[model samples]
Target: MELHHKLRRDPSWHPNACNICGQLGHQAVNCTNGTINWRQIYGDEAFTIKPPVFWSEMADKQKKKEVDVKELARRAREYARMQCQAQGIDYDEMIRGAQVFQHAPEQKPQLPVTSQQNGGSAGGAVKKEAPEGDLPEGWAVARDAQQRVYYWHKKTQKVQWDKPTKDTPVS
Candidate 1:
């Protein structure tokens, strides 16, 4: 009992418990077990106990991003131009001109019940004419789904067509 008391009283003896290994006699560094890689083991908690990361080590995740979409698109466009050049195709000539998309015609509103009883529509209302258009220029003969033949007039933008005889079946 005296010897045990003397050992406890010795200067080298550590009264407090070790945070690592939990041994009482020595400091954590003097532990018999190999040094713990707290960063690997405890992860985020390691930062609380250890020296912090250097200022130079900080980074923006966006700077490390894999690809720029605009850059990729520009590269792809260049590649297409190169391929067109290789094939002896004129890039400008190969491109068909852009066309405006036609929207569905707006529906005419129904006459009010009171207006119908009055025997006339509103004074401001007027019927709209459909746009005058025909088959594309240079197209000789146009065929409808029913196989009716059409001749387009470039000047008048009119389609002059022959109606199929009733006896001639469309398939």
Candidate 2:
């Protein structure tokens, strides 16, 4: 009997399983139904849906965010390394002093000198020797290891590495 009909006939009776095949939701008549999920008919992916575009977009955004973070972290490490080198602190001694051994060095790992371009108020400038004519008047450009470009206003000594606001000039 149908679940509804059985319920009507006996109020105490409960439909715990399928009334047709006495199994789960599957029925004997529709056991081979291959419209919704074709896994019943075929064993491979037949017509899978395209993943949401935002998944790739989010991944790109995340990659950009990671590069930005690495750039900023590189700046900080350069500053620390400079200060330590000035104080004549050896790399091993500084590492022990900072107790960085407990954590992943990935956070403060030393970046290659070639990774830096511009050198001024921003860290990593020591490795960069910008030629006078290479840059426009009162303007500088720095590139990090990730190849992320940073625009420098030499006049104001201001550096912009991320998306610019409307106030920033297009040129």
Candidate 3:
């Protein structure tokens, strides 16, 4: 019997109506007709098919993101070797000292032997070297191209723009 006819015949007819299949006698939540096959009912227009993926291309992209430790170490070693060559410093010594700045010895003007023999002094214009006692152990002062003094710590491989005090080191 139709739902309206049954409802007309009996006013107390409270049969559960399923909203999914639209049938009488079970609620929509309790309906057990499984999933609705949209493709079966609506044909190929139900959903679009995606193009097949190339796994090799995806794998290559994933591999590019990962780093090889050995390759990185080799590159780092090569860079350090290049830096040592460019700076004219010993790579082994630099590696051992860790951060030590081995400054190239400054060339000083030599007084002529005749001037020394004549007992004439080189004037009072002698440039005094920066005192090492002010700096901490394994630290030294160096001048840049502008002659501005910068402190270097060999062991820590650190540089500071300000002057280091005897009691405390400048960061």
Candidate 4:
């Protein structure tokens, strides 16, 4: 008892209590109580402990949603088949036509057609023939596959869609 009293009286002798749970025998850094008594540690401000998130449960829910979507798709297909049968339409042919329409290339609006003798080109471009000797010096006229007339300046190596005359800039 004297040795114990002496040891307790020693300056190095100290007792440890957890700042988290206010329990003896452990410091806050070494606390292992699994839960902290916040009211005992931090004066009386209310605190709520949130539950831990489980990623596996979230992944399971996502997989279940995917299965439900697949089931809905199957039901829709069966309903469509029944409707087609009632209408006397071939279901497979109708499905194939729908898929073809979905995957088919888009169509472009068509231009009006005119006979080639009327200056209509193969590519639907309307062209007019320029009179010979109408081009300025160093400029020559050429026709594209569309029969569209284009002008080229030989000295500048410049090409233009419009016929180049003396008033056309060199550039």
Candidate with top lDDT is 4
Candidate 3 structure quality by residue, lDDT tens digits, 1-171: 567645433344445555455567865444567365555666765557767789998899999999999999999999999998999989987776764545546776654343233223243222235565757677888765434456788877777654556665534
- Per-model TM-score, in order, reads 0.23, 0.20, 0.24, 0.29
List residue ranges in candidate 3 displaced over 4 A: 1-60, 99-171
Highest-scoring model, TM-score: 4
Model with the higher lDDT, candidate 2 or 3: 3
RMSD of each: 23.2, 20.5, 20.4, 17.5
**How would you encode candidate 2's per-residue C-alpha lDDT over 4-93 as one tens digit per residue?**
746533344345543333445653334443234445466455436666677889989888777577878989889888988898878568
TM-score of 4: 0.29
Q: Relative to the true structure, how large is the alpha-carbon lDDT of every model?
A: 0.50, 0.56, 0.62, 0.69
Pairs of residues at least 3 apart in sequence or in different chains that clash in candidate 4? none
Q: In candidate 2, where is summed lDDT lowest over 10 consecutive residues?
A: 112-121
Question: Per-residue lDDT tens digits of candidate 4, residues 1-171?
Answer: 246644434344344444445566866444666366546677554445567779998899888777577878999999999999999999999999999999999976645546553344355445657555878889888776655576788899998765667899997
True-vs-predicted CA distance for residue 91, candidate 2, Å? 4.3
For candidate 4, the 10 contiguous residues with the lowest summed lDDT are 5-14
